[model samples]
Target: MRHRKAGNKLGRNHSHRRALLRNLVTSVVIEDRVETTVAKAKAVRPLVEKMITLGKRGDIHSRRQAAAFLQTPESVSRLFATVAPRYGDRQGGYLRIVRTGFRQGDGGEKAMIELLGAEQELGAKQQKRAEAKAKKREELERQLAEQGGNEEGGSEENA
Candidate 1:
């Protein structure tokens, strides 16, 4: 009975499924990587590749088409500017999906979907984020130490 109906329903109706895919595509376009359920990732892969294909087109009609499908203007611009350019020489297979693990709740399988040529950029961004977090932690610790020292000095003075 289920013939020619290619594509997972994901238990959602048509509109909801379209919206979910649109959001997922937008997130992947903006972040260059997104962790999602395996089915969702697989569903979004072709959509993202299509968007990149539109980006490669790099015309007004393509831009409008991308804007209509994607969530934000920023994603459209990034697709046209950053993501599309990276895949200019390549033909297809713009995105890759890697199985990460299963979610603790409900035991759903999780996978990471990412643009193919964005490994270096993603790595650098993650490293920068880690360094910033470390710097903030050090600053907070230094402030706490200074506060403790000041309190000790005051207590000694009172004594």
Candidate 2:
């Protein structure tokens, strides 16, 4: 029979599936990324994208709508204030999915779902930290070189 159905049931009823998707969407919004089953990631991608699209409006109705769907004021605020603004210039395709092998227990496929702009921010922070470390290392090397030169000159004078 299973002819007209397009989406996976995931062994859950209608309400349960909706709830699961909502929770997953909320987590993704709050954390900007999450490791989840590949099927779940594919299922929730459009929902998260639509929520971000709603957030782009930045209005009362849109906020309320997103809040209603996400069920948390904090997540809603973050989506509007932080997540959405980053994607304001871009069109669709707000989420990225990367396959990360399989779960060891049941051997289910695992994947990482992440918002596009969030990675850039993380990378920038890492880059800044790396740059700072590199500068400190260079300074230490210069100081050591100068000390070695001074020691050589002092020893020459003694000789």
Candidate 3:
């Protein structure tokens, strides 16, 4: 019987499957990348590419259609304002899925689905995070040093 069927059901009914795909598409648009199981990454790739195509159209009608399908208005806006423009000269193949090995719990294969040409943005974000972490570490060390100094001074006074 299962002759002409396409697209995996992902073990959910129609509504839940639609919702899950919408949320995944929204996350990919907003964050430029998402780490998920291979099956989900494969399932979401086409929808993300379709949204990017709509964004490239740059019309109100296309925007409305994308907004209706995507999970959030912010995703729609990002898709139009930032994500779409990056592919102005490109044709298709907007997304890429890279295998990242298997998950620990269920042994499902893991993959990272990301928009092409997003590496620079992701790198900048990573740099900012590293800088923030370094700053926090320094602050914590200063606080510990101050506490140690205070404790030594207090002990001396007690003596």
Clashing pairs in 3: none
Task: Write the residue-wise lDDT of candidate 3 on 111-145 in tens digits.
Answer: 99999999999999999999999999999999999
Residue-level lDDT of model 1, residues 1-159, one tens digit each, is 998999999999999999999999999999999999999999999999999999999999999999999999999999999999999899999888999999999999999999998999999999999999999999999999999999999999999
Report the Cα lDDT for candidate 3: 0.95
Highest lDDT against the true fold, candidate: 1
Give me the runs in candidate 2 sitting further than 4 Å from their true place: 2-4, 123-159
Candidate 1: lDDT over CA atoms? 0.96
Ten-residue segment with the worst summed lDDT in candidate 2? 117-126
Residues 78-116, model 2: lDDT tens digits: 999899999889999999999999999999999999999
Error of 1 at 6 (Å): 2.4
Poorest stretch of ten by lDDT in candidate 3: 70-79
- CA lDDT of 140 in candidate 1? 100
lDDT of 2: 0.93
| lDDT values, one for every candidate | 0.96, 0.93, 0.95
